[model samples]
Each structure stands twice: as structure tokens, then as C-alpha cells.
Target: MITADKFLIPARELGFNFFTGTPCSYLKPFINYVIDTDGFDFVDSVNEGDAIAIAAGATVGGKRAVVMFQNSGLGNAVNPITSLTYTFNIPVMIITTLRGEPGGPADEPQHELMGQITTAMLETMRLKWAFFPQTEEEVAPALKAADEYMKKHNQPFVFVMRKDDIAEYKLQKKPAASKKDFSITHTDHFELDYKARTTRTPVLEVLQKSVALSAAVIATTGKTGREFYEVGDQKNQLYMVGSMGCALAFGLGLAMVKPKLKVIVLDGDGALLMRTGSMATAGAYKPKNLVHILIDNEAHDSTGGQGTVTGGVSFGTIAAGFGYDKIYSTDRLEKFSEIVEEVKKNDVVTFVHMKTQKGSPEKLGRPKVTPAEVSVRFAEFVQSK
Candidate 1:
């Protein structure tokens, strides 16, 4: 068996220093080593999908990232893997443990089917993968091949790890104490007149003009991105297409890696509700350069205006509960613009919940720029000073 450092040291030398993933028994030694090491950064994501999105964000910010998770949770990561990484051509290394290896070891009944199909599932996703290096000599060649593939294709490469591939390494770091003094403050002024409330177009116009040129903007899927693109496409903007709920997590990753660059997420109510757990991760890390702006129209506007559960939900309370450093709620466009300006002046994780009318500009169209093109330019924009 190989020591965790044998693989990790070289991986770090090759620029894979940022790590994020959910915990797994097979990954204990590898993760422990990263946590204990001073040069590495490890983010404990709430789910495997969030892990992927975060890693992708880091990759976009010019950091080589590695995501680790168990095979059982691989299913949870498929959506972002296919939509976010594949569609955007963002490469990040993925190390997934083999929980239920056939004829290797008897595992829980739950891992049986997943174990049997783990490699098959990777193949189905069109992800290039290899069995993880088990011996000291195998480590270099394995990493070289994976690195070469990722650099060539600009897509994710997987390493399916068997149990006990790395020697045991204990964690020496202690978890940080929780902050008890922080409190949520809201500035709710929801206008009862729905007709008088501003629509998405005007809000996007304000945002396009308000945010600085160097700041990176991540627009969530569906109408939010479409409307933002329609308002004006900027080099600093990344329009997410298929990854519906990953904008905040992506922004979190970018914000963490590129702390000097402002990362703003344009989120929709339906999308935010789909991956609310990401907020918990944001709260925990509390990246000071990140800004979350939610335009809650209370309906799935892109999907034929189906009413969502957000009408009864108070997102300001939810953001507060999730540990956002700043929370503001407003329905008026002027107030929303003021909140955006205010958040830009602060060095804290902020959330703005804006209640807007439920319609887009008539005949709204998708961005002419392809997802791949957008990602390439966005990564360049992110890495630029």
C-alpha cells in the first residue's frame, strides 16, 4: 500500500492543492492528510453535487481541485458532473471510493448495486477513469495519465479508489468554534401591489450597471440567466445553463479561491430551493467576497409560470438561519439597487432577497455564446487581475 503523502505531495506539486468533498471511510487517510497539511485547503461540502460545483468553481478560478466522495454518493454528483463540468468544459479531479467491490469484500446491502455498477456508471457518464493507485510505484503514472487527460480534454477525470489503498493518517486539526454573536438583520419592505413591483429586466439592468467590471457574476439557470444575458453580456459573467441549483456553490468556490475578486450569484427562488444545503456550506466558510442575490418571483417562470412554494417562504429568515453575515429583503427596485451597492462596500458574506414580478422581457432569448465559450472566457476573466 502507498502512503497518502506519496500521491498527495506529487498532486500538490502538480497544482492540485484545493480539495473539497464529503467524508468517506476509504478517504479518511487522504482527507486527513490534506486537512493537516498547511498548503492545502479542504472544504467539507454538504453533498457530493455541491462538492463538484465547488471544485469546478475553484478550477475556474485557476486552482487545480480534487473532489473526493464515496461511491454511494456518486449518484448525487452526476447532475453537476454532466451539466456543470461537462457542459462548461471545466476539468477537476474526482476520487470516488469503491464501497461494494465484487469478489473483493462483502459490504453492506446498500452498497451492492452501486459497487457493482460504479465503473459502469463512470463509463456511462463518459468520464475517463482508472482504478486508483495502490502501490508506491503506481502513483506517479496514475496521476500523470489523469493529469494529461484532463489538460487535453478540459473535462473531469475520475479515480475509483479501492478500500485500503492508502496507509492510515490521523487528523490533528480541531474544528473551529462556532460564532455565537452573529444575528440576522432584514430590511423587508415588500410592496403589496404586484403590478407596481419591478420585473426581472429592470433588476438585471440595475445589476449589470451596479457591479464592477472586475467582479465575476454567476447567473443561475433558466430565466435568470436568460434575462441577465439579454440585459447585457459581460466578460465577467458566467451564464449557467443546465446546472439549476449550483450557482451559489460555484460562487462560493470562486470566492474562496479568488478572494480578491468579487463573486456575485444571481439565484432564482426555485433553483435556490433545489439546493438549499449549499447555503449551509457558504455560511460555514463565510467567504467575504461572495454576494448572493435572489430574485424571488414566486413562480417557475421558465417552466410555464408554475407557482412555487417560495410564496410562503421568508428567505431572509432562512439566510439568517443559515448563517449569512448580512441579509436584506426588499421588493422595490430602488431598494434592491441600494442593497447591491451596500453589499459591494462590505467584506462579508451577504444575501439579498428581492421580491419581483413574475414576468420576463417579451420574447426573451438565450445567450448566443455557447456554454463552452462562456466557461473559457469566464475562467480567463476570473484569473485576470
Candidate 2:
């Protein structure tokens, strides 16, 4: 039997000592070893996207980060994987535990599809990855190769683990905080230069407006994602890019997969405009659980603020037409807050529209948690349902 602890020492040697992820039964042995170790830094992320972002940020800061998650969390990590880190040249190590290898045994229905596509999806992203080493001796070299790819190419790498590879180990205390604390300065702020005569600003202000109201927030692709993450509690929120208005779609998936969680999808005019079909989908599903907030800035702000259909179209009318149980609109913060509060009482999908400015953050940083941490926390979060 391989001793998981020994493989970890090589991880330390390779300068990939920091770890984060959600635990999969397929990865439990390795997860236990990590949690039980004293020298590694492991964070419990809310989901795979959050973990991927965290690791991306850490990679930019000159630390190698590894994210472990189940094959299922791939759907959550896809946007950021392609848009944020890949577009920006940030490198991270990802490890996914394979579940439901056919004929090995009968597994849960949920894991079957994930098992089939986990590796293929990684390839679709063109990520350099490896499976868990069959022998403990191979772990060091495999990790070394992964680290080299990250440093040389500025692209993400992955290490897929199998059930047989990871064995149980004692939980370890989290490593002490590293000596250096890095903070990102925002050079780009999508702001409204002209102060509004009324309390309301443009629809983009919905994110800041929501945070001000202490409402849980999420941001979609492009500037909306960056601005929301920039303004909200970085640790609690989820953001995506290149999904191009599929924010609600992802949010719906999260809501359905995790029923008890109160999910708020911070969608933009362009994104919602692209995936308007989701509105009907959501209406049909009747996820009484989600509040779909559309920030109708009326322009593709990230893509140079091009005018959108919402400029002449009424989003509020659209929401009502689409069968939203409750619909609200506001150009002012006070009105925004009041409408959100009123909508809180409804047990159906609610839509909120706000006007925002056409500006993007100057610099963007990805999340720091590894893929692993996100899966672990997300699953735990879901289970708490």
C-alpha cells in the first residue's frame, strides 16, 4: 500500500505546498491526508469556481495552488477556467477524482455522467493534466512536470486522482499564514461619472446597491463579474466570465443542485439578452428559490459599451411577460432596496432590473482557492441543505 504522506513531501519540495478543494469519496484518502497535515494550507471554498479563482490569484502572486474537486464541479469551473485564468495567462494545478468507472462497481447515478466526461472536459480546455500516480514514487515527478508547465506556459495543469490511489491519513492543522500579504489595486472602476439627481444610478449599480443592502450577490461574465467581485465580500461571492450572459443558467444549476441555498444571479443586459431563453426555463422550473437580478446597463460594457436591446426595451415588462412571479425595477438605491425586500417574500423566481455605467475594472484578479477546496465546501454547503 502507498503511504499518501510521502507523496505530500514531494509536493512540498515542488513548491506546490498550498492545497484547497472539496472532498470526493474518490479523493477522500488524499483529502484526509491534506486536512490532517500541519504544513499545508487548505481553505474551504464555497464552490469549484471560487476555488479556481482563489488558485488563479495565488498563481499570479507566485505560489503554486492545486484545486481538487469531483468531476461534477466541472460545470461550475468551466467559465472561469476558459475566460479568467486562460485569457490572463494565470496557471493553476487542478485535481479531480474520477468516480463511476464502469464495471469496477455500481455507483450513484449522479457520478456516472461525471465519470464519463471528467477527463474529456479537461482536454476540451486544453489543460495539461495527469492521473494520480499508480505508485507513490511517481507523485514527485508528476508534480514537478505540472509545476514546470505552469511556470513556463502560464496555463493551468491538472492531476486526476483515482479511488485506489488515496488512502486515509491523519488530519493536519492548517499551515500558518505565509509571510507575504499581497493586495490587488483596482485601476478600472466601472463608475457613473455624473452624480444622479435621484438616489438611483444606472443598472450596473445593482451589484454595489445589492451589497449595500446586504443581499447575497453573484456576478456574470464580463465587467459585471469583475465589478461585483471587486465590490462585494470577495470571500463569499461567485463570479464568472465568457459565459456571456449564461449567469442565470449557471445560477439555476447551482440552485437546483443545491436547493436550500438562497442564490442571487447578478446578470447583465447583454448576458440576459443572449440567454433570454433561460428566463422561460427558470419560469417553467419555478425555482421559487432564486432571485434573478438583471443589471440593464443597456450596453455591452466590457465589450466597449455597445448599445443593447434594453436601451429601448423595458426589462421589467420583459420579466413580467416571461412569467416571473414577481418583477421589480429601480434606478435609485433606495427604491432598489425596497423592491428587493418586497420580493424577498415571494416563493418564486424574482427579477430585478437596475441601470449601470459602462466601465470596467482596470485590473482583474482570479480566485485563490484550488478546485479541490471549492468542491469540498460546495458539497458541504449543499449537504447542509
Candidate 3:
């Protein structure tokens, strides 16, 4: 029920100046205000945990901090909070904008469960947090209470607010950046007219070459997974079932745990377009053994074959902006081999872009396993590391 300016002023007064996290419409007014202001340092972190880590580092260096994020990102923040902050006695204030509140008209089905579990998750971590303050007047006191709680406990505390309570602000859209192609050379062995073929053969050839050297691969949903599955052994690959555009997170966890083995992720244009922030997360935590191979088909081929933003959208540039040091693109096979060889020895996170065919094979069905089973397999894989 509080105005964005009101809470922001008190947050400033409390010495909480540094802000980090993903954008939320409900939190935009507060976020944009800090961004436009001269004094406040606002960083749009790749995920919630990155925000937490940034805030934690700032706190350690003698600055008060705030991390504002969507409740859906709580899953991503839990590890850092419990392992790094809680164990290390780091205190940071978290302000999360709640999405699907109970009794609010049903929101996107994808967010329903995440919404319901938000508070329970905080409790499970034994961290202190409170839902929407009862009135606009309560915002300042709630923040103060959380600050006091953090000081006393040396643990993170969260303030969750509903959509209706916060104000929205307009965001300035930047001009589109120049496009960069990730295709190197075509490894296609066939002699057909290369320009007319509908298959993603060139990209598949590159992925096959990568998998031949790597121990594990994770593919995001849509055409990338389909094509990667088409070219490589599914037994060594984790077919992402439901979580669209989350292959990097999977690869990050796997790579972090198993630094000795190579972890590859086959990402898609549509899938990456949906959640591009994962690239920043990929960059923040440098893992030498991790390789993200993006299969850019340039369309949402799995869902009615709609055109994607990436046709005009350049993921290669985006990866570069997110701090991927080794970025290469080519439409030819020699270039592909050059980039692949360069990426193989790098001791840092890498992103490879490969343009592919527009559509996947027809009659694709969901995996026979349930979400729980998929999670179990992923858990087992991570544990094996």
C-alpha cells in the first residue's frame, strides 16, 4: 500500500543505497528512481542470488544494501542466502514483489505455485520475512523492523509486497544493437545447395563435435533441444522438460559442482529470448569447464511456428554485453572449427552461437517422466559431481 517514493526515501535514510535484482513492474518506480538518481547505485543482476551476492559484497565493504527481485527468483537466491550469507553471517535486506497472491484472479499458471510457496520457502531457510505491510504507513516501520532484525540476527530479511501496493514507472528502451552471427563454418558433409536446406545441419554438426568431447549436455526446450537430441545421444543429455530457457542455470550448477568434466548446454533463440538475464548469471560465476552452445533457429517453431524476436534480435551481441569474453560467429565450417577449438581450452565461461533451421520435427511429445522425476534425475546428476 506504500508509494514507491515513500519507501525509497526511508530506505535511503536507513543507509540502504545500493540496489540489485531483476525488474518487476510493481517495483519499477522504486528501481527506476534509483537508476535515474545520481547517488544510488542500482545494478540489474542476472538473477536473485547474484543480487544477494552483490549486496553481500557491498555490505562487507561498508555499505548498507537492498536486493529487490521477483518472488519467482527466490528459487535462484536460496542457495546463496543459506550457504554464503547465512553461513558467513552476512546480513542483507531483500524486497521481493509478490506475483500471484491468493484470491487474486489467477495469474499466469506458471507463476501460481511459485507464488504460493514464496513464504514457505523463506521459512524453510529459517530466514525472517514478512508479506505485504497492512497499510502504506507501515512500509517505513516494516523496513526499519527488517533492518533492526538484520542487525540483531546478522541474517537476511525479506519484505514481500503485492502488485496493487506499488507504483509503476516507464522504462527507457535503448536502440537495438548491431547483429552478430555466431556461425563459424558449416561442417555439413553433404554436397547439396547449402543455402536451400531446411535442416539445422551446420549447427547440429558443431553440437555433435562439441558433445563428442564433453561429458554432459543440457538442452533447453523447443527446437534447440529437438535438434541437439537429433544429433547427439540423449542418454548423456538432460532434456529440459518444463522450464523453458533455463539450460544455463542447469549447466551452471552442473559445471560448478563438476569442474573436472565439461558441461555443455544447447540453448535456443526463442528460449534465450524469453530469459536473457541468465547470460549475466553465466558470466558472473566464471566456470572454465562450462560451454553454452546456442542453437539460433530464429523462430518459435515448437509452438505453432511463430517468428521470434531474434530474427531481428541478436543473441551474440547480448552474450558479449553480458560479459562473455570469447564470442565467435560464422556461417561456414572453418569458422565453426576455429571457434570450437578456441572455446575448448578457455578457463572461463563461454557462449557459442550457431544459426540453425527454422523448424523442428513434427509430433513432438512431452517426456514420459513427471517434473518430480526430472528434478530427481537432475539432482542425481548434480550430486554425482
TM-score of each: 0.97, 0.52, 0.51
Instruction: Give stretches of model 1 more than 4 Å off.
Output: 179-187
Better of 1 and 2 by TM-score: 1
Ranking by TM-score: 1, 2, 3
Give the residue spans of candidate 2 off by over 4 A: 170-385
Q: What are the per-residue Cα lDDT tens digits for candidate 3 across 42-116?
A: 766777765775575455434677889988888888766775567546688888877877677668887898888
Residue-wise C-alpha lDDT for candidate 1, range 200-259, written one tens digit per residue: 889989988988585899999998999889888888999999878999999999999999
Query: Which portions of model 3 show Cα errors greater than 4 Å?
Result: 1-198, 230-233, 333-338, 362-382
Q: Model 3 residue 193 lDDT?
A: 40
Top candidate by TM-score: 1
lDDT of 3: 0.68
Q: State the weakest 10-residue window (summed lDDT) of model 2.
A: 185-194
RMSD of 3: 11.3
